[model samples]
Target: MAMAAARVVVEAEHLLPPGGLAPDAVQTPGPFVDRIVGLGPLGEEYAVVRR
Candidate 1:
């Protein structure tokens, strides 16, 4: 995955919609992003859903 190879900050609103990223807001799509940095006050990291 390109994101896995480098550092990337994805723009997201929430992570509890129970569905994939917003169709219109999808920048990289799936299969390319191996993970996603969660929203935190002091900058935290978390793994998102995988294919």
Candidate 2:
């Protein structure tokens, strides 16, 4: 790990609609994540990413 307090930014195609992400669908676990954001080029969603 680079740093314990390190945070990462993630850009995704779409935000979690309403149902949320399924356990199997999620690539990373929630504890490792810091936060989530919504990014827009044409009104898209953004999220926090970590390793």
Candidate 3:
């Protein structure tokens, strides 16, 4: 199980952008607070929240 999980993570990482997901200067919409926008390697969008 651990190996499988690690493999999945590695595959996912490969799908990420060259430098990995980069935090955008824009903020997420809606009532959520402290969330930032991110872009992936394939131009995929992500809403990331930092603790």
User: Could you give the C-alpha RMSD of every candidate to the true structure, in order shown?
Assistant: 9.5, 7.8, 14.7
Instruction: Please state the error at residue 37 of candidate 2 in Å.
Output: 1.7
- Model 1 compared with the native: what TM-score? 0.41
Clashing residue pairs found in predicted model 3: none
Report lDDT (Cα) of residue 1, candidate 2: 38
lDDT at 44, model 1 = 33
Residue 8 local lDDT, model 2: 50
Model 3: runs farther than 4 Å from truth?
1-29, 42-51
lDDT of 1 by residue, 1-51 (tens): 455666545545466554655678666765666566655443334345332
Task: Provide the TM-score for each candidate, comma-separated.
Answer: 0.41, 0.46, 0.16
Candidate 2 per-residue lDDT over residues 1-51, each given as its tens digit: 313658755456678874587888877566666766765565223334331
Q: Any residue pairs clashing in model 2, and if so which?
A: 37-46, 38-46, 39-46
In model 2, which range of ten residues has the least summed lDDT?
A: 42-51
Tens digit per residue, CA lDDT, model 3, 1-51: 433342221222234443455557223322333332443454324435322
Error of 1 at 9 (Å): 6.7
Q: With candidate 1 superimposed using the best TM-score fit, by how many Å does residue 20's alpha carbon deviate from the native?
A: 5.7
What TM-score should be assigned to candidate 3?
Answer: 0.16
RMSD of 2: 7.8
